[model samples]
Target: MTHPFPPLVEAYLADLDRALEGADPRERSETLAAVREHTREALALRGSDDDAVRHLLEELGPVDSIAAAAAAGTPAPTPASGPPLADTLLVVLSVVSLVLFIVPLFAVGTVVWAGTRLRAGAGDRSRQKTALVIGVVALVAFLAVLVSHYVATA
Candidate 1:
């Protein structure tokens, strides 16, 4: 008798998945990926009746079942990698760069510029940090002296 569930494609995928359960790690990976691709293709040609799903299932077999089976047998796959460098560090430098003046603005500015470039090029965070520190300190020292001189006179 023709099976009642018109979602034959889904049934076939389930069976395929079951079969893959008994497969080796490498075999399971390839089989599951292939079945997933077939599933995509089947979805694209989707029909209103269950017949299309059945037909696709007949053509593809039980992929989800195969996947379930494979899952039962083996370990999970690896995930994707993440990016380096943090947003916080970048923000810190930006904030610090603004509160500077006094140390021959040009010289301090150049250090900040070169330090920023160095950090970007070499992936060395310390370079920019050091530059920022030097600029701020020199500027503060100069300002302190000027303030002292003015205060003593007045």
Candidate 2:
């Protein structure tokens, strides 16, 4: 049996999906579903052929242009508004924790909080990951220094 979506149509959809990757999930799904439905309707009316699919995709315009239009229509908040609060806090705490080993418990708390936010996708993922890395490295170095100091004194 012929597939519901022709190979050309499938390729077009894949291109659209790639273009829409940065869009919100709901918007991306809605856009893709709408395009697929329109393609099916056109196929039904014009006959399921390569030429018809190509014509339809051409009329729809390039996928990158469509994505650009969608992104322009959407109101994405600007990073200039301020850095993400949780990520900023994570970085600060990581630095503080490194400088003041007297509060290892608090440092652990910061790591846990950053990890939670990272898992939840609540902050800048890269920033959170960097903060966690720095925190972990600082913690390890602090412990090593303490062990060496005690051994030397003994």
Candidate 3:
């Protein structure tokens, strides 16, 4: 079995292929491709050593579980989609507010709106957090400018 992949990887793939038997043709191929791509990426990043390959296989989990998921018509979860549109919009608005720090009211409003939405668990956590951070920075900048102006006038 002198294949390009390590022996462990080869065995794992073989077992997965067998376990996937009776699965839909398209699903089976897609599953195989996803597994292969994952393996390739891991090997490239972690090296092809036995220990690394063994760990990678562990992370992939048992081939039986994967086959079971496929049989159940739930393709293995993959990072195929981006954040929701609302989340993206929040992030964009946050950035815009940060850039237009002169508009202190708008920046403060954006921060409050983003914070409220985040607390309600309305959208993706990461994007909401990003929006919050940017909004806070904008608020801080605006406050500093206001203080500096008052001090200079006085």
What is residue 94's positional error in candidate 3, in angstroms?
A: 1.0
State the displacement of the C-alpha of residue 56, model 2, in Å, after optimal TM-score superposition: 32
Mark the 10 consecutive residues where model 3 has the least summed lDDT. 75-84
For each candidate, what is the lDDT? 0.52, 0.73, 0.81
Best by lDDT: 3
TM-score between model 3 and native: 0.50
Candidate 3 stretches greater than 4 Å from native: 1-69, 72-79
Those runs of model 2 whose alpha carbons end farther than 4 Å from true positions after fitting are 1-82
Q: Global CA lDDT of candidate 3, please?
A: 0.81
Relative to the true structure, candidate 2 reaches a TM of 0.46
Q: How do the residues 108-152 of candidate 3 rate in per-residue lDDT, one tens digit apiece?
A: 777787788777654477788888899899999988999999999
| Best first by TM-score, ranked | 3, 2, 1
Give a tens-digit lDDT track for model 2, residues 37-88: 7677566545566776777677777888767766666532211324467688
Best by TM-score: 3
